[model samples]
Target chain A: MSAQTLYDKLWASHVVREEADGTCLLYIDRHLVHEVTSPQAFEGLKLANRPLWRKDSVVSTADHNTPTDHWDQGIQDPISRLQVETLDANIAEFGARAYFPFKDPGQGIVHVMGPEQGATLPGMTVVCGDSHTSTHGAFGALAHGIGTSEVEHVMATQCLVAKKSKNMRVAVTGKLGDGVTAKDVALAVIGVIGTAGGTGYAIEFAGEAIAGLSVEGRMTLCNMAIEAGARSGLVAVDDKTIAYVQDRPLSPKGEAWDKAVAYWRTLVSDEGAHFDHEVVLDGAAIVPQLTWGTSPEMVVGIDGKVPDPAKEADPVKRAGMLRALEYMGLTAGTPMQEIGVDVVFIGSCTNSRIEDLREAAAVARGRKKAATVKRVLVVPGSGLVKRQAEAEGLDKVFTEAGFEWREPGCSMCLAMNADRLASGERCASTSNRNFEGRQGQGGRTHLVSPAMAAAAAVTGRFADVRTLA
Target chain B: MKAFTTLDALVCPLDRANVDTDAIIPKQFLKSIKRSGFGPNLFDEWRYLDHGEPGMDNAARPQNPDFVLNFPRYRGAEILLARENFGCGSSREHAPWALDDYGFRAVIAPSFADIFFSNSYKNGLLPIVLPAEVVDRLFAECEAKEGYRLTVDLPAQQVVTPDGTAFGFEITEHRKRCLLGGLDEIGLTLLHAADIRAFEEKRRADQPWLFA
Candidate 1:
């Protein structure tokens, strides 16, 4: 047998059939669902009179439409309320392996909850209707996002009709500088590759820097793969992967655990494997990164200045930068640190794990939010994450620093709920995207890491976390 | 699913690269359970001056005069001409649902993000990928001429311009067949139910932990 990449091995093992045109009916082992993308899919199943193939393969939760604040008050917006109710009705009608309702202890963003519950395992193919489904690929699973129609297809057939993506390796070597976290590495990668760089390929993060990252850090890296235009991002499984999956609620028990571990050990790429594309980055040179424009590719170090469109050679790109600067209320040559922010968001599927919260809390331990900063929101990824943070006194650390400790949901990430930015309000966010009107209509979002967001919260501007005492 | 054959219609040129899904259909409107009614809210932020919510009367909203979608000449245009990496962010099928509802039969672009491209096919919206230079030429031609239209022949795999210039595009045989037939992918895949079951059975025997 020829040496195979990790993607190749996963694709081959899951092939139920291959059509003449080279499309494969790939078997799906896990399907994670959230409120925003599932309603239409459930309706599709009902319209077609199709039954779910394997209820045991599905794990669902309501996150997007659930308000991160005021759980006791219930969802204030009627439309948001209906969406969450619709998911609950669908899950009740079609049973799943697990269904975490809005206030369920296990409830969280589907991407965060899936791996946290051990439902997302190594050497398996995972999917969700949300684009951030790539987050589960950090577990060495072949995970990617699907459309609502494909969600129905997966529901009815427990399989996906997929075309295999080409293999691309992004190897980051050398040591990361102080305060240069996984979010910085992800931003730096996007900066090098541009937004559409990995369009048709599955990127595998490798080399010494990738190996040194913790499991949560690996997840943060893979979470932004979608921002780089890749459907999936992966990392080969190792001891850290094994340890993370060992005692989770849904993990295999007793004899099955040993067998699963043995099989997962083989999930790595074979030596001498071929790759269609490869990129190398020096991690030591990467500083804390932030987005200066609407696109993730429009990123620079925290010390860098806003890019001048006059220096741009491409007219389209220059126009885009100009539009972004206007939308973000930024000037061409202004230093990034000089920019002030009205709000700071520290939550999303990208960062909101216990580690992310701890990182933010470390910076915000005793510091007070600047008077000019209107609000600082610290939303946990899951109810479990919230509970864990509270246990570690991380919630107190945030609240003591004048931050609002909120419940678990994708708060202010897409801002489908009431937690959103006002018109023209500038926010330092730990979320994934910086697109125009993403946080809210006319709201400006600057993408940064959890610590960066905390630092911005304390100083009311983009502050360098490394320079702190 | 409506079968897509050929579309000869006026072109609306959207001269922007990386037009993300959020720009196509904003998140606020995604609360709907049904796929219809999204067309009115398509490019809501860019198309209108005020912020758009789900139940707001789009008819009363002040339209952005500069937006191409609002231009009198581009009204009722069924073909959208766009630049590179159109539909670049988020996996919301609402983007295509909105495009289809807005009466766009086909979108010709330099490139498309993978997920949006796949979702477009499922909703009967044909996404045609042309070279960047060819797309540039189309944009220039569409802007220069009023009521400029193009004919997309899916069966022939060519996009024909008003001046009789035809540019070829690629589509897989399986996708082409499905699109032409207005076929349901779930039904098509279920034809091989036995194959799927066999594969599952083999996996269960080999890696029993997955089933557990």
Candidate 2:
């Protein structure tokens, strides 16, 4: 038999039909929805006068624009209120499987909640209206983001007509150094392959370094795969994946669980599987990484100096570097550790899991927030994660260190809510995307891992977590 | 959906690289799900000098004289010419919606992020991928001549300047057909409704527990 990559295996099994033009009608096992993108999609369904094809497969939530502070006080922003209310109405009318509204125990970021409830499973195709839907691929599911129009298409048809993506395997070899987390590996990969390098490919993370990551770590790795311009990122189903899924709230049980695991065990690529592109990284060489510029690709080691735009040969790249430096208030040759921050944000879909909180708490356990830092916010990805953190006293540690413990939502990541950075306020953020005004209008965001953000919170600068230890 | 057969319109050269969606439509303007009102807020941060909130009268906002869109010569332009990696962040279909709403029928760039490229086509906005040198040439021409116009013939897959210089591009036949026919994807999928129903029935029996 010919060799098949894991992506090919997953694509073939879910394809209902392949057309002459190379587009395949792929079956979607789960469809996740959030407030910001679904209203127009639901309106499309109404215009077509069609019912949802598979209500049982859809889960809806209000996350993107939900305020982290005073969420129960009722969303004060009228526009945000309308968007969230629209989702509640759309779900009720469409007969969605579950709708986690604001203040619900399960309410949180859609990508984070999907895996926690086991709606995302191995060998399935999961999709959401938001791009970070790639996060669910950590469960070995073929997951990716869809545009709002495609969201409407899926809601109406329960399928997506997608082109089969080329397979690329990024193998991280060697053992990771101390204080180097999965977030570091992700940043390292993005640094190696510039933001647009993975375009039109579905990446499979493989090899020893990947094998050592926990499910949460793998989720962090896959979460940023979109930042690399790959819509989907995957890791083959392993014991860690199975362990994470087994006995979860929505996972199959008893005989059904046995049948499911049996199928999942076969989800790995063939022994001689071929990939169209391969990138092998020496994991030992990676240090704690942080983005110094606007793009995810503009990263350096925590101790590295800021790059001078004059050194950049490409005129376009040089212009970008100059703009970023001016906006970020950074100077050429300034070490990252000397860059002071006005705020520290340590949670997002990328790093708000329990494991991420534990890592952050370890660094913030016995420290006080630097006087130079005006504010620090620690938000969990989901209410469940928040409760779990409080149970383990991680929340207490954060609050004791002058960090405000906030409710779960996509807060400060994009800052759609009121919790936003004022203009020119620099932040060491654990969220993805450092694009101009991503956190707020005229605000500057420096992307880092949760541990790095926590360390920055205590030190008021981009401090390497290893040095603090 | 509007049929996109050909477009002959004035070109606005946005000489920038990696023009992300956050810049295309800022986060503050993302609160509305209606999708129609985003035209005024397109490039909100760059186009206006003051902060823009929802329900604020766009006409009252102070226009940034430095922005390309505010220049009188580029006014009423329906085509955009830009540098590489345009529309590089977020899967907000609103980015394309804002362009379409603002009367842009096509975007010609050296390259585009995949999701934005896909979203552009789906929203009846033609995104033309030209070589970087060709894009640079177009940018130069647009700057040198005010109200510079380009004629894009979708069927011919070519963009022709006023001086008759032409640059050919490529598009998948499937996408081209959908655009030419003004076909709605949901309506087309409904044609296979019976087959979808049959597949779902068989799938349920094969994995009954999945329904739970």
Candidate 3:
């Protein structure tokens, strides 16, 4: 057989048919749904009088609009309440294979819940309406986010008409320094390649550095692939991936487990497979990165100073830098550590896993939050992660440091719930985007790792965690 | 879904790059289960001074004259002209919904985020990608003329200026067919139901745990 990249192999396995045009009808192995994007899709199905093609292939949860605090009281916002209610009604009517309603023990961010339950598997094709669905690609699945219309199409057909994407390889080499992490590596990659650099390509992250990361760490790396403009990012399946999925609730059992494992071992790319584009980065040179401007590309090392717009040669880029600087309320040439913060948010689909919380708890142990820091929140990605963190006493360490250990939901990341930044509040966030008013109407966000956020909570400013250690 | 064979519509120049979905329609408005009402709040933060809560009368709100959409000249524009990497954040189909509901039939940008580009075609909104220089020229022309417009001829794959200068563009034959026919994706996929069913049966036996 000819050499094939991992993505090419996965794509070929799922294709039902290739049309006269470039589109192919690819079968979906798993379709995950969330509250924010699925309502309209169900509504479309109702309008068209269509039945769900295969109910067993779909799973859902209510995450985006759920209030992290007062979970027992139910949703307070009228619109948020309606969205959750709509999902519940749709799940009942359509008969989804599984549904984790708000406040359920299994309820969490869709991306977090999928992997934790083993719904995402190696060599499978997974999709969801939320862009972070790429987080499932950590398991070597051909996963990506689809629009609501595509969501409706998947709901009705159990397949998607996908156009093949060019393959790119991002190879990170060398050992990571202390206090650096997958979030740092991801940020470093985005920093090297601008926000739009990965457009029109499916990136396979490779090399010794990628092979060394934990499954959770790999999820963090792939989760932010969308921020780099790539719809899907993949890491080849290995022993670590199989081990992580082995004992999960939905994983195979007995003789079936062995069969699945045998198939998964073949999911890796052949040694001589060709990639359309290649990027190589040195991992040791990377430090904990923080976004200074609006775009993820506008980043600098933790100890670096804000970039001067005057130094920018491109007029369009210069304008964006100026806008970000003005909106973020930072002066060019000022050290990033000098910038004070009002809130420190250390959760989201990106960095809210058990390992991420452990990193933050290590920094927060025996340290109290600074007087200038008003609010510090530690939200795990899912209820199961929350329970695991509590069992390990990471919640206690966080609460002692003045951080509120909230329920697992997309709290304050997009500010769909009551947990939001008031206008003009500056935050150190572990969430993906830092667009203007993303946290709130006029709030500012700075993206960082969980440890970095924890350090910011204690210092009330952007402090390098390396110094704290 | 509306078929897009040709449109001679006024162009609105939004001189910005990386305009994210959150800015297209803020998170507060996304709570609605319904998708159609987003247009009035499209670019809500930029277009209005006061906060836009659900059910608030859009007309009653104070409009920011400085915002591109609120300007008198570009009020009813059907085409949006923007810079590179437009729609770069969250995959809220609401971004295209808000754009479509706000009376826009098409968007022209130097480049577009992948998911947003796909969503636009599915929702009957044409996202045309042109070179940065061509986009810059269009922006200049729209700014210079009070009522500048472009005649988009989809069948010919050309955008013609008022002076008769034409710029050619390219799109996949599949997307072209869908846009021209206004074909619903779900309906299109249902036509291949037998193939989908056969594929699922094979998958069920291969990975029984996945179905469970």
Q: How well does each candidate reproduce the native contacts, as fnat?
A: 0.83, 0.64, 0.83
Model 3, A80-152: lDDT tens digits are 8999999999999998778899989999999999999888889889999998888988999999899998899
Reference-based lDDT, residue B181, model 1: 97
Best by DockQ, which number?
1
Tell me which residue pairs clash in candidate 3. none
Ranking by DockQ: 1, 3, 2
Considering chain A alone, what is the TM-score of candidate 2?
0.99
Candidate 2 has a DockQ of: 0.72
TM-score of each: 0.99, 0.98, 0.99
Q: Please identify model 2 stretches exceeding 4 Å from their true place.
A: none
The DockQ assigned to candidate 1 is 0.88
lDDT of 3 by residue, B70-163 (tens): 8899989999999999999899999999999999999999999999999999888999998899999999999999999999999999989999
lDDT of 1 by residue, A1-469 (tens): 9999999999999999999889999999999988889898889899889999999999999999898877899999888899999989999999898899999999998888999999999999999999999998899999989999999999999999889999999999998987999999999999999999989999999999999999999999999999999999999999999999999989998999999999999998899999999999999999999998899999999999999999999998999999999998899999999999999999999999999999999999999999999999999999999999999999999999999999999989999988899989999999999999999988999999999999999998999999875
Please give the range of 10 consecutive residues that has the lowest summed lDDT in model 3 chain A.
A70-79
Q: Give the top-scoring candidate (lDDT).
A: 1
